[model samples]
Target chain A: MNRVNGDAVLGAAIVVASVLAVLVWVPRDTGSAIVEVVRGSMRIGDALAPTIGFSLLGIAGLILMIEARATGSTLRLDRFDLVFIAGVGGIFLCAMLLMRWSGPLAAALFSDESYRNLRGTLPWKYVGFIIGGGFMIGTLISLVDRRLTARVYLLGFVVALCLALVYDLPFGSLLLPPNGDV
Target chain B: MDYVLLGIQSVFSNTAMFSVFGVGIPSCLVTLFLGLLTGIAVGATPGLAGPTAMAVSLPILISVFGVRPDALLPVFGFLIGVMKGATVGGAVPAILFNVPGTPDAIMTTLDGHPMAKRGMPRRALRIAHFSSVTGDTASDIVLFVCAPFLAIMVERFLDLPEKTALIILSLTFISSVMGSSVGKGLIAVALGVLAATVATGQTFHPRLTLGIDGLQNGFPMVSAVLGALILGEIFVTLNDIWRGERQASTVQSSHGDVADGLQKGDLRRIMPHIARSSVIGTLIGALPGVGSTLAATLGYTVGRGIHKRRKRPEDPDFGEGAPEGIAATEAANSAVSGANLIPVLSLGIPGNAAAVFLILAADSIGGFNPGPAVFNFTRPQINPELVVAFGIFTLMALGNLLNWTIGGAFMRAMSVMSRIPIRLLLPIVLMVTLTAIYIQDTRMAALWITFGFGILGFFFRRLDIPVLPFVIAFILAGTLENTARQAFSATGGDPFFLFRSATSVIFLLMAVAIIVFLGRRKGHGAAATHPN
Candidate 1:
């Protein structure tokens, strides 16, 4: 199979998954809630609108896949391509995991009560961001440039610090991550 | 006439003018400079967008300014400056690194990269800057003149059914024209609407959340946009860099100086292209949902057609480092920045993402609620919203002036700004994106939504799907639903209510015609070019 065809297959698979999730899984799980909230005013047609939309989207994806398969625009990924994908995916995964677990991790590291205090836990939260963000960025830079340097790490650290500080400003009464209460 | 006079008077009203930092600096001027500088910085950076910059700053600015009447102009001044500044700034990366900061600048890279390769990078930058400022100024004038009139017309003729049909027509037309395949474009719009349907407005039970508490308010607009547009693009770039298909190269290695400005002959040659493109940009901008990317693409095509018709031996080859090519794309895209406000101010329908954010700010800040109500002439009482809108127009004018005078120099300096490797830059961008979303929504769940949507965006882009239709659809989803529901209920659930209205029927037919015509044209083009 060519690359374009491969890409189309992957896209079709995604659309199919989305269609099931939107049309079936979500509706089944939440339909009762919707019925209760709308007081049964929600018509079958209204409820089915989004499902129809996703179904159409799936058909469109299928068309694109068939066209790509016919055209035969294909390519193969080399080692670097895999690494790049992994790097980005890894970063996203890591960041999501960090944001998710940092609160619980903080609670475990300290007392639950202490971890609950946002002002007190902010420094530790910053540390988590800096270390995690710096390490991933540094690794990616080293891999791409074929050399490790302090500049990328230093820049990452400074950027993370600035981001944390700006977000923590008193303007909106906003706080950075590890914001368990919010 | 009185409204026009009030708008002009409000531009200089003391109520809107204030000092910054307890210094004598005017608040409007200070905010304009700061917003423009931030906009230029963000726009010069690849993988960032104007709306992203606006989104990042919006909540913070709202918090700082509060929703007080006195705070309206300062907050909106900054946002308006950013909107205009970013359009001019996006050209910097396109000219310097062959990497467009915004999708609208993709056309710029064609002739711009070649010009830079020929060691006239500064010349290209000048052409871009000159055309952008000129186009922006001209479009702003058009917006100033036409928006109120359009708003009055819409108010008079468009009932709920007609309005809803108009939106549907816009969605259909935009989806049809954006991508190579109509199916893919419509699919993108559908998916966008689906994404938006989650935790959205409905009369019945909360829909599509799957019982998740965090999904109740739906995906935060900032998170969705940043994830899908900014972070997703970064992911694509990472893969390209890894595949050895692209490099994190800077323009510092290319020697150029801004002291070499555009010659009179160069200006004369590109003048027609700039003029024609600005008009095209303004016209398209007035249409709801069509964006700068389309404007830029159409402008370049039309300019090329014009150049071909008036072919002269001295004319630069249309695609071979032509100054006119740069002018056409830059002017059209920049013109879109101002003209986009037309629909927003007149009809309260945001024409593009930037205008969406502009409306968001105005809505949140409590002073300017855009629509025909803004243009409402209340005797013995001035409309504050109208005044605020005028104030924003004044700030936009100031921004254009600054862009004309110093935009080239700013872009020149940015040509070598931040030699930070993409590997490093991407991660920082990631951090900023996360921080911005987290601050705005204050929820870890929002971050997850962003990441998930980022992945979705990466895949969509990978399969050559257009993202704009999806974005426009998502942003307008709530409006679409509410309008349609209102129209239906107003007609007592009559299925043919839309057909009963002449305007609604016309709009729906136009939508169908657009789909059929564009789809057939696309098929013919594909057959001619890529016969199997």
Candidate 2:
């Protein structure tokens, strides 16, 4: 049996993806022709650049696979990498969701008006960012420290608050996080 | 001559003044100082880099001073200040903690740590500072003299087809030189081009956006770039920390108390090394995609050879508390900062990540376009872009002046930053970066796109694919497509428009030759290693 290294596996995956992008995705997504005549002058279309890029990508992938097969160079992607990515990604998604929702939730629970009306106000604008940003920082720190402490959470909130003030103090026009969305 | 005067005048003009101690100071100068201070702190931090600081600060700078023409100088001044200060500050950690703050500082650790242990830390630091400032000033002088002339030549000679071909050559060169393998680099460039195609500019129809409304307008340039370069790095660092792949250095080297100031005789001894290394660094930096690490290695090797031949019985050997070694490495790496701007200011091509941020700033601000046309002196009218270019040069000069005067003191003060844990700092950086991006874009979709690109960047790093090629290619894709389209139309629908001119044909042929020659050489080496 012949042994295949991780570079070969990665290259083969890239080749497959590139082929799909060129044949399936590009045609389906791009609405314009590769060459179009506009006002009686021939011009390169929207699709040509991407088509060329994907084709080159495919060729490069093939070359990479061939070279990797010859070289037997290994690329390490262990289970730990997957878990770390997933964990970090989960934290990011949760933080974003909290950032998106905290302001609206605050307005619904505390204020008579919608988040849209209260977004430009002082305390209301600071709510979502402090909650979400603080949570992200604190949780990440805890993840690193292997233990969650109240001091970490407090530090996170303080840092988030400081960041908010830093942006909000001088710049009247600038909106912080969920406030802009609201 | 008029434009030069105008540019100098623009930088010093009373526009955008801030009051300090009942006296008016130029805001740009103030921002430049602040940026220098921030850069020193960032550089002294072990895992932080200049590009990361620039990436996080750019959107904030833009938001603070809108995108007006007046904002260009202040913004550029800050970025340039950071670039200059970071170069000087990177040696601090290498000297004090035996940890290189930046990649180029890897060479500095060889002799610097030894000098510190020998109770000459201050002397080693002085040598590094003097060498760094001198090399930086020398390279800045080269940039000042050479960039305009190169731009003039490119303007006079290269047409659209030739320009297109030049960009193609640059992309090919960057891909070939950057990563472990040319094929991987090419893949990175191709992916960058593909990512750039999602933007709805330069064509009648939106292309490759997958019917997403947020992507219809395109991924925010700042967000995508910051995500790929900065956030991606953070992700990888965090993962390493999580998986116990990275560990903090617990060994503490005591700073011995001794008279460690650089004596006048020491300066004379290291001067030749500094001079030679600065020249080597300047030449290497001018090439696209080649960076300071190579310059540092070459400088150290050459300096060691020269030192060996001229060795005195009393003098310390190279890499063993040798002041000349510190001078050579610091000078070489620091020199790259100024000469790296040659491609950026003249050809509108960024050779490295720092140059990429500068290009991004100019692109976002929209008053200046960097290219051959920037130096079109034929026009009787005052060229604003030319003046802005000179303003940038003036800012760089001012940055060097600051570095010469106060950069050493500031850098030494920032050594405390190295003690901060990377695991703690990176997450905070991630938050700050996300916030900065959010404030500029004011859209959730932009953050999502940034995260997605950050993931892609992580994969690129993990797979040993170079990110600089991808970034340079992404930035250049629009320009290349626009130039190609114009050339194709101008040549009466000729499909072979890239080969229409001799210069362009040569450029195209060079691009192909580089790929073929380098790729085959790499293949032969691989085949030799793995004989079946």
Candidate 3:
């Protein structure tokens, strides 16, 4: 991690801001705020759960930055890593700002058919476009001096894809519920 | 108890049991056959790993057995065989080409390559065969018997916090296992956790998947794993090729008696080391997420530690082509395979990256995923599943024995086996890979996801990124979410109600302490690296 001072400063900003926002905006009632899968709900077991998880994640990011500073190392912050974190942050911020209504938006980000729920949100689509655009640029930069046999790459990709698709097509239907009820 | 009676009854449940005898047994034979062919190929090539054989096989297992509950035993059985066989097969390449088939086989290359260079390739193969079989068979028994019992104990103690701790332990174990830097280990787990996170459903919200509905099901682990591990390595190979790395010089074999040439005492000579490796392997395997590195490292260190440095012949010594090297490695490598299953089978948590995905596949196919309850409670009485497992275990033991004893005998003719090079081998590998993945879960998206993951895996390796954290995160996501949700409803939205559960609070505190510790300076004045 080179340029540890910069990374620490930047990482500290990201983590601290995110953690603070998460802690502040989150419902005080850990029980109701936290979502579950197996059990329907609970009465405040780990109110600090997400904050803690995220906080830990933040701490990790921060520590990484500090270490990078100490080592005089720098993480080549690419469009991909930074943008992905930012996008996640944006989703978190939206969830915090919009309250429960944000659930659908959150779902949209999570689900493949997010656009259906958020049909009129063309601006958000731009967000998606920007993110995609950034990643493609990253890919371009990541591509080095090597003539990858387009045939081998293509063949590998195609074969892998076809196999993946073939497997799913027969049972992709299983992805949905048995009788169509949610 | 019905468990014992059920076990007896299962033997007669010919429909399923026969699959083991028929499909499972034959698959074991195929494992031997494939093991030989692969051993030759990997032996002939440099840098390819033996476990990639299992990687290729896993997706196939998922596909072919995806819809059927009964098929798991055979599929997994076949997998076990492939794993054991590949270890043996790796020696083929190690012996003839002076190129190891697996990372573990590098030690074999030291001596075997020298022997081959000196036109004693047959001798090197015989020594490898002699020792690998002895060590592997010894290790498998420990895996078979102890795995079930440990699993039983784990079921009782496994809880969310403890599960988290176990994962942490696995991380540490991984760190210590590879004399590789802790940063690398941490990076591996981080990436693994990140990978697991990619296919989030129960977590707060998914990251990485930009509104792809397919992602809600979570990252199709099989393909992703294949892509990351297998395909990613392939890219590295391409990189090496572009860099003009020297490949093994291919040559045809001149036949010789495979094992007859080796002195009888060589088998007896390596036994103590083999036994020692089995113990080390089993101990490492019992823990979750601790993979082969632990077993191999322990085996290697101990073998070196206890070895009486015999005065060497000018021909080349232990580091070059010693039999004990094979003993220690085979013991550690094969033992790790069997033992790695301990945590997964006993506790529902996967201890290693491979086991993590294996658990998902097992859970999806076992008609239910494995968990703590699966261990202690009376299982879904399937006319004696334990009996079936016992049979499979018995077969695994037998299969391993067969591979070691006969497989070693066969490998003496390393000249016959090590001719296939990477150029011809890569395509066949892809073909097998496609067939296997197609059989497992049969999802094209999974396949595509695999390729994408392959790239991710490659970059992660190159960049020294950790995937283990990602995997652990994914595993914990649902639990964390559900625990939070349950805590919420129990208190009727009173966030303070979380204080009621004294147990949960203690666990949460421990987690905090861990975070603090992780943030603390690791050792000396160096920047604090995460433990795992």
Candidate 4:
């Protein structure tokens, strides 16, 4: 395999992104000119700062790419890195979904009220976070330890519970994960 | 002088007090104590840092005490205490287990571990504590004198154009000096500024939001900062663990007996080194983005040279259990914590990660804007910000007093923190971080923003991009844009407004010079070392 320089690749991506941001994104998204003159007074437009930022980013990217090509510094990620990132992303997505939906699911099955109504109450408030947070922690630990144990799962749930209590107990103003969303 | 007295009075006043056993104790003092304790524990832990603790605690502290004006002192007291305590606590793991709890402690291990091996670990810890506190105190004194003076000078002389140019110079210097590649650092800074531009500025319409409702208000500052600085680091560490690249340290603790306390003549021998290293550290710290690691290295090198010329035949060499070596490294590194705030308090430019948090805290808790305006000495009408600044100084002094009395004993007891596995602690930290952010914003979007920035931080770390410049730029982007806009408007839309004043012109030229000079030097170095 021909290994590519990570700096160069990153630089190229940034340059492309910056160009698009400056030309397409800034023009379409921004509502004003780079510099607006109202009557006799002058003011900076909304597009000016982002335009400068993106232009500078593009220049920096060009410099980085040129430097990388000249130096020939090799830095590239392998299959394991990709897989690990994917695995972590998958776990996070699952955890977020579980946190978002577990309360509603439990409330629909067991409770007379909806999760939105019970999100402030005890068992219902703790359900989604406990289950989702536990799974996130337990699965990550197991992946790192390269072993699946009931003890790890228990530790995870215990940690989740402790966190929930720490936040929920003291402050009435604060809400646990997905509770506020619900 | 009146402002100073008012500030001190505020700290000592019964205005902000919490009842303890029917006795009212100042809340600032209490929080300072708690912060110091937490800082010591966090610093002793191998993978944790003062900034991380400060980041996690900021939201909780804000929640506990709302963003009211009176909340400023206690919040600052806690953050400053953590900053001070962590510097002293970092020596624990280095001395006992040969594992540096912080990057600054790496130099400490050179001599500290050797002292531990020789059954003088207690003596080493005491020396480190004493030297660290002395350096910290001396640096604090400098900050007290210099920060106000510098801010006043800036306020008296500089206009909008000059200020904007100065900001530009600072950004350029920060970007050029930080990582191996100046290009990469500049790229990181540009990205940060771009990210910061997502919010609505002086104009009514938000820029760079991509028509997304969530991004219209921009990413929450705390979430974005914590994600990039803390979560990103956690992800990288976890990735390393997954790759089996990092493992738990197996170094056994070497407990020193009570007889290992500093002897009668030990302080006399180490004082000169402590003084020299403290001055060195303070000077380096005053410069933005030049961190304590350099100070420690420089202090150790200078101390070693001095030791080599004065050593007796029976004495150990530098790094061979020499007390002076540990003193030099610890003093230099610890001194930085106090002096690094000079830029933050005086110029609103954070010189380090810890200073970044201090600025963040001040920003989050309104009524204290850290800049030239903060030191406005308009008599009769009492500047509240100046009073808050003095209150911060008082809290720092209290922190030092605590260190002088009990901080050593506490630090020595925290050596066990080195033995805990980072892999286990990190997952819990992740959960806590998520929870903390959620509690602050009370929305899933904040969590997602944090996650996105964390991934960005992870890639930046993987690519060896320096994150500090990015963070600093993110923070200063608003000020820079506002100042420039004001300058331009003030100059009647002159394109050459930055060049109108000699000071601004010089600052702009210096900014360009730094980039060009550093870029050439970096290129030459890379070319000389290139295999091709």
Candidate 5:
């Protein structure tokens, strides 16, 4: 894809997102929740401010795309770029989910005392650490040389453990996925 | 004069110390030393920058020391040390592998690499170290002398309207001068200000949240910054690695007798370049928006001009492997580290991304705000914050001393450091960044904001838009809005109150003139590049 096409696609997506935001996303009061921009007493509904702003942004993006086409500068993207974006985004999403959701679920599976003493008695929340850290490390190792092995996962685990000890033991800082006790 | 004496006393006071687990630690000096060591390690890594190290460490450091007024000097000391040490450390990888550890070190690679290739790696490293320390020390002296006076002046003269206009002028300067086009820069700033408007104000009402519950409290400053600047860069690096865009580049490290130290003649030839570049860098650093990269480029250009006029038959060519080249680049970039703080301390406007991080730390930790009010001194009472600022200045001097003594020996170890693969290092960075934000806020919402901003930042990088303007806009928006409101209310709700103050009018005019001038300059450059 050329710069023009890519920019056009982006502009269209932004426009669609803005329309959706104004219609479905933004909560509106059925009767009198219209946002009022007031200084002293005089006021006007400003609920359309964001909609207008985003529409302007979409127009600006379209202009940029048109200018790029006129200049004949091809900012190329291939199918590989889409694949790369999806894979990287997928990894990031997985890491976020693991860091956020795994600890709570793990704690729920354990007894109340165990859940309360997650930091002192048991180390269940560190499951998020192992999973998130391992995923990041695996992707990183593969990135280095397109190579993946058990050694990479082991190295990732060790690295995660060392980080956990540094922050948890000496600093007593917040852990990833957070101990639900906090 | 009384303020000066008080500041000096505060710099040496034992009250600056903090306790850890009931053991009293001399926070100022010890933290400064540790920060300098960490900075050297961080700067020697090709993928990390000074601000990245500071951003990752700040929340943890705050948690360790606790956010008390007494802890101010210790935190400031560590940050100043990192800022100074990183400048010197960046030249290590630039010399060893022809890959700059930081953006400003790019110019150092031209001559520093060639010198290393010719088996005088130690000599190149020594020149870089001496020049960096010399320039840093010089700039710190300038900062110590100027920042106090400037702060006092601003406090006495500037009113709310003037301050508001000054921020506007700074935003315009930053947006117009950075990035490829003024349009893109302005767009970035607008978006940033819009982002900042969400979930803000004392009334507790949230706008621009699209009714999302998590966003009603606004984005966490640390996570937003870490996501956009640090994690965003990590994503970009991962993309490059996956695409095999970065090739492995290295130079053979060799030992020779000539590498032991610089000869007297070598020092004599390069000292002029260092001096000239230091002055240039200090001047540029005191300005808003322009950063060390520009200073380094300007210093290199000026050094080339001077050398050409005074060339001798026996002297090395400028690009081949001149110690003068290394001196010029290192002095300019290192000088920027200290001088960059001048605006932040005096005017409360950060000069660049690293200084922005410093301001962020001060805000999060509390007790010190970086504006002219911090310098307020009455008849009998003295400003305690001014004393803390001076203590930070004192720590900067100590950081320079460390660079002068231990820096060269440390540079040799950077060769081994540069060998670390980016793949292994970046994930560790990600984990640390995640932990820092989580520890500071203890909220999962902050992590989501970070990830979202990280994606936004990645797209900004891909699209060739400048992130600095956006960051500056986001950081300054609250102050700007508050000042504007105050100014308007003071004028009895006059819509044209911004022009009532002469200083405000002048500042607004300057903003307009700067935008027009930069737009024309960009137009000329574009036309020259693509002339029909």
Candidate 6:
């Protein structure tokens, strides 16, 4: 109950703060702040009004939501199961981000030229495979079934090989850009 | 004394900041274009960042037009103008192609892509592009106030370790706020730091050059950035294309209605997060190397946390197409472009990747080094330069404001891309990947790096790693490490010198405290299930 009340109070406070800032503080510096004169700045004295006006307009929306909450609307949330996912996301996200900066990791793993070439290659086919394979493997054996895991492993390897052969299969044939196109 | 006044005049004497007023004119053009076309073509091509459009064209002004120093103002003014154009243009492809034009386009993908698939690509593209530009322009003004105001304080901050520690705190913040786990964020950072160590030897000799002459001077910044970040994105696209079975292009229908367009109700709901995102972007962007990505995440996270502490009845949509998501992302990403300069002007540190490139250019001209001395000596002394900065900032603000009101409409035109089969899209991404990297130097080695990072990135994404902190750490590690080394030499290699400053002490404590707090959350099962 206290938590609920606290949440409500905070919501009210946000709304109140928005209101106060818009009503009192905004007008005092209306002329001085940067946002003024954005709209119709084709002329002088026309800029500041729109900037502050829109800001307050935005604030008004928040206030309405707060008042409506006396009925029963709250920001949607997934239980703890989902919110915490953001944490794990941070990990994998960071890993990929760091990998770009990791010249050592790249050099250790692959040739520099080939590595540079790979960035542009993500196609729908790959997305299809991941999504399709996930669905197929997921459906065929619940993904965790012992037999399914081996099949998925085999399937992935085979697909990877085919991809290497098909798209990355090199051709010495060269043609210059046609002058008309160029 | 007269010099200062003259410099100030150069900046503002253009008919009472009218030059600044002229800058916003581009935004009006961009926003209007967004409205008219409802989309832009070719911006979604991989490796083209919002700033790249300007970077590539910068030389044309010099070589073709024979621009003098006086012409630099109008030239950069045009580039800044182009940046505003690109920010809105970037959204078109992001909505249509799922591939983003800039990192800021990443947010547009969440709902915009979905809307495109539903055949309302036009509406989604227009609305999102509109919302994005609006939010972007709004934040630019926020930075106009916030960065200079913060500079007054950041300029006074004298502790090296504290600055380092603050960066650590920011890294920690990135990890915690990522959709994955802190462990992953940390692992990524470690990996990034390790990556930065390559080819950097003690002094006379470059390490890990490994017999490559080009590498002896270290990876060229363009190649490295292009290779790791850009190519990596492309390779992943190719990998996806290869793995998939969907070979046909998708045919999407158009969904349009005035009521379906963003209603006042939509804008009303998104305001708070918009405000919050603007503030966070302004604050973080003022620091160097912590660019739009961190600002983006910070804004995104504030929205995420808002869900946890929901006050507004409309909070549930926070992550989805909720205006807050769009608002936060647009505001934060755009604002950071301005904020990232604070460090460049106040300190010599380049705040983000684009700034680093600019710094290299500025340095070649015997410009004052980017530190306190620059402010005192280099700043007020240059009459025209001050004019340039002021014109740039004020004009950029105008450009952004104009972007907000109408630029998104231009992006909506890209809905035609949905007509392409998904299969073709995937393979095209691959082909484009090959062509782009090859153009960097016809080096095949970059391809393999792209492939490797793609797989690595895939694995990291699969495992839920926070990519941003790792990227940031990678960018900053060399500088941070070098700074620490210099400070050490300044104190005769005493390791304790890092700890000697009271400012350092305070930053260290703050870093420790933040890590402990965030770390404890890790210790609990709070993040166990997600385990990125």
Instruction: At residue B296, give the lDDT of candidate 5.
Output: 95
Alpha-carbon runs more than 4 Å astray in model 4: A1-4, A69-77, B14-22, B202-204, B254-259, B524-532
Estimate the lDDT of model 6.
Answer: 0.46
Off by over 4 Å in 5: A1-82, A101-120, A173-176, A180-182, B15-25, B202-204, B248-259, B530-532
**Candidate 2 lDDT tens digits, B116-165:** 98888888888989999899998999999999999999988999999999
Tens-place lDDT digits, model 1, residues A113-141: 64455434546556555655555566656
lDDT of 5 by residue, A62-176 (tens): 4444434333222334665557667767776777676555665677776565444564434775766666767666666665556777777777778777777777777644555
Q: How many backbone clashes are present in model 1?
A: 3
> Under CAPRI classification, how is model 6 graded?
incorrect
lDDT of each: 0.73, 0.86, 0.51, 0.87, 0.75, 0.46
Expressed as tens digits, the lDDT of each residue in A59-91 for candidate 4 is: 888878877876655444567766877787788
Single out the weakest 10-residue window by summed lDDT for candidate 4 chain B: B249-258
Per-residue lDDT of candidate 3, residues A117-156 (tens digit): 4423433322322232222222221222233344434443
Ranking by lDDT: 4, 2, 5, 1, 3, 6
lDDT of 3 by residue, B1-532 (tens): 4554543343334233225535522433343345444443443345555556566655545554454665555555555555566666676776666656666676666556665665566666766665666666666667666667776665565544444444445444443233223333444444454445443433354443545777766666556556666766665554444344645235444433333346566667677777888778777766665566557767877787666464345423456656676667666666776666666555555666546555555654664354444434354644334554554465466566667556665554444445555543453354445346544544545545665666675555455444444454456455545544554555566555434555545555654554346434332234433221
Clashes of 3: 82
**Which residues of candidate 2, in runs, are more than 4 Å off?**
A1-4, B14-16, B19-23, B201-204, B248-253, B521-532
Which is superior by TM-score, 1 or 4?
Answer: 4
- Evaluate model 3: give its lDDT: 0.51
Q: What TM-score would every model get versus the actual structure?
A: 0.86, 0.96, 0.68, 0.96, 0.90, 0.55
Candidate 5 interface RMSD value: 4.5
Candidate that beats the other on TM-score, 4 or 5, i.e. the better one: 4
Per-candidate chain B TM: 0.89, 0.96, 0.76, 0.97, 0.95, 0.67
lDDT tens string, model 1, B1-532? 6655555455455343445575455566767778887777777877667777776687677666667876777777778878877888788888877888777999998888788777788888889988988999999999988887887788788898898888788788778877666767787888888888776644355667777787778777767777787677777776676656776665454544434557678888899999999999988888776779889999999998888778688767778888999999999998887888897888777777787777767756676778766776667887777777777777778888887777667867775443545666776666676776676666677777888778777766775667767877787777777777677667766667679988899999999898778777776675466555
